[model samples]
Target: MNQHILNVKRRTSLVTVFTLILSVQLGFIAYSGELKSRVPPDQLQEAQSLKNPYSVTKEFVDKGRILYEGRAFCSVCHGRDGQGLPVGPDYDSSSQPLPTNFTDGAWQTARSDGEIFWILKNGSHGTDMAAFMPQYVSEKEAWQLVTYLRSFQGA
Candidate 1:
């Protein structure tokens, strides 16, 4: 009976050690910025602040709508309401991330207009989202999409 108890204690110790090692590795991945897929610190902030020469207006939103629905074909994946589809992982998901849910107020509040524009233009590498959005939409059109996306925060 004492030998069995000792074996169980040894097994528990091994699991505890393994868990600590795994946690440290994951924490390092998050802190090292590998998972986020961008440069460290203010670089992303600076990059995100570059303004588009194109105007943000209702007309631009309309144009963006056309591009998103027609040429960009974002609706098929992101859904018409920006609720996101299950076919793809959540764009914000830490693993196999799917497209962003524009409807999330907390998320919208945290992101700036320029940051959103940059992501749209550059696309996320860790996720399925591609940079093709910029290939199809003009800078102006992309900004318009940003405006339209903001509307989704409350919806």
Candidate 2:
């Protein structure tokens, strides 16, 4: 009886959390009629203030491409071209928001170089995004990916 009660309580708590998250997402859309970014306001501001540390060149793009495709395997989730949509839980088990669409000029424009780098370093919370710490990829490599991802704009 105690075990059953505990299970019920746990399930109820999970449902409540899920409902709250869904409600907030719905509220954001209804209020603005715009897709709400998963990132928090403080993170957004901090990311916006950052600047790219390196000048983008073909060599840098190539290097980034290697990391993004190779060890990183970002392509698996983000796609080869790096364009994806948030496939909800029905389609994907994780139900994390979609991978970023780098080709979207307006979307890319809204994010700062620092923001991208920060995401790469720290990863976004409340989502499936995993941080690529310096142990996995150096700061320079992360910056290279930013350059490569930005290149998708206008293409």
lDDT of each: 0.73, 0.78
Off by over 4 Å in 1: 1-42, 52-55, 88-94
Tens digit of per-residue lDDT, candidate 1, span 23-74: 9998997654433433335568776676756666678778777776687788
Residue lDDT tens for model 2, 1-155: 99999999999999999999999988877644323444567677766677876888899999999988899878877877878645655766434456777887777877777878888888877677888868689999998888888878887
Q: On a 0 to 1 TM-score scale, where does candidate 1 land against the true structure?
A: 0.66
Clash pairs, candidate 1, are 89-98, 90-98, 91-98, 91-99
lDDT of 1: 0.73
User: Which candidate ranks first by TM-score, i.e. highest?
Assistant: 2
Error of 2 at 69 (Å): 1.1
